[model samples]
Target: MPQFELANWLPQVAWLILTFGVMYLVVRAALPKVEAVKLSRAKVISDDLGHADTAKTNAQSVEAAFQAALVAARTTATKVTGDTKTTAAADAAARLKEIDAALAAKADAAQATLAKSQAKSLKSLEAVATDVTGDMVERLTGRRPAADAAASAVAQASA
Candidate 1:
């Protein structure tokens, strides 16, 4: 009997009123709270995502700074190496120049000594020649060469 009565239009009207009243009360009471919870969760997730993005940007900035420092260090090292090489080359050149100067001075001194020895040897040879010519003239005709003729003969022999 109750099932047959529920299927009738009068029972249908009663069910409609009950369902509408309950649904309106539930929506009025709970819908705002649910919406508020959803909006709060969305804001929290957005904030967390923003923090992650900021962290990523900060890491990239740190990497860029590290790379710049490395480049600076490499440039400084290269400059130092170039400077050292240039300094070494200059020092070597200076040492070579000093050595050349020393060698030139020694060569000049040796040349001067040789020239002095040659002059002394020439004087001795001239004296011996004069003595031999005087001895030959005395043996041949009993006369000696004059001083001027002896001087001229020594000059011609040197030439």
Candidate 2:
């Protein structure tokens, strides 16, 4: 019944207006700060995203550079290996040629020695054959053959 009373209406209206005005002032005062905070957070998040993008791009470029360096190293290694193989083959060929030359020289010397020994042996065999023939002729006919004749006969038989 106090709510319905005509004398309480103006006071109730005044209280409602006061309460609404205070609430409006409070909300109006806080709205800009809230909006500023929200804007600051949005800016920070954007900056962080930009930094992440830059880092990703840098990582990609670094990876590309590393791959390029690795490829270059491999190419250099292959070239060096090929060059080494060529050099080694050349060295081996040179050494083999030297050995062959030495062996040929040795063989030629051995051949010369063998020829000298054969000549000496032939001279000794001729002297021995001449002596045997003279002794055989002396025993068979009671007369010795001349040294020159026996030597000539042996030479003719050999020819």
Candidate 3:
């Protein structure tokens, strides 16, 4: 009942106005500090974004340089490997040619030696065959065959 009484209304209105006025002045006084903090924060964020972009660009350039170097190194290595293989192949062919020539010379020498030995053995075998035929004829007829005839007979049989 007292809250709603007409006679107390003016005092309550006065106190309410006084309280709200003080709160309004305090909020008004802090508005510049809040605006300053917001501006500083925005500047810091903008600076960070610019730095990040610069770093990204630098990283991309460095990565491109590294890739170029890698490609150049691979090309150099491939060329060197090809040159080495060619040299090795040439050396191998030269060595094989030398070995083949040496083997051919040795085979020719061995064939000459074999031919000489075969000719000497054939001469000795002919002499032995002539003697055997003469002895066999003398044993069967009690008369020795002539040396020239025995040799001629052996030669004819062999021919």
lDDT per model vs. reference: 0.89, 0.94, 0.93
Q: Write the candidate numbers in order of decreasing lDDT.
A: 2, 3, 1
- Assess every candidate by TM-score: 0.60, 0.62, 0.64
RMSD of each: 5.8, 4.7, 4.4
For 103-127, candidate 3 gives per-residue lDDT tens digits of 9899989888888988787778788
Most accurate candidate by TM-score = 3
Q: Give the TM-score of candidate 1.
A: 0.60
Per-residue CA lDDT of candidate 1, range 1-159, in tens? 775665587877899999999999999999999999999999999999999999999999999999999999999999999999999999999999999999999999999998898888888878777777667767887888876677677778778
Give the C-alpha lDDT of model 2.
Answer: 0.94
Query: Residue 104: error of model 3 in Å?
Result: 0.5
In order, how many clashes per candidate?
0, 0, 0
User: What are the runs in model 3 whose C-alpha is more than 4 Å off?
Assistant: 1-35, 135-159
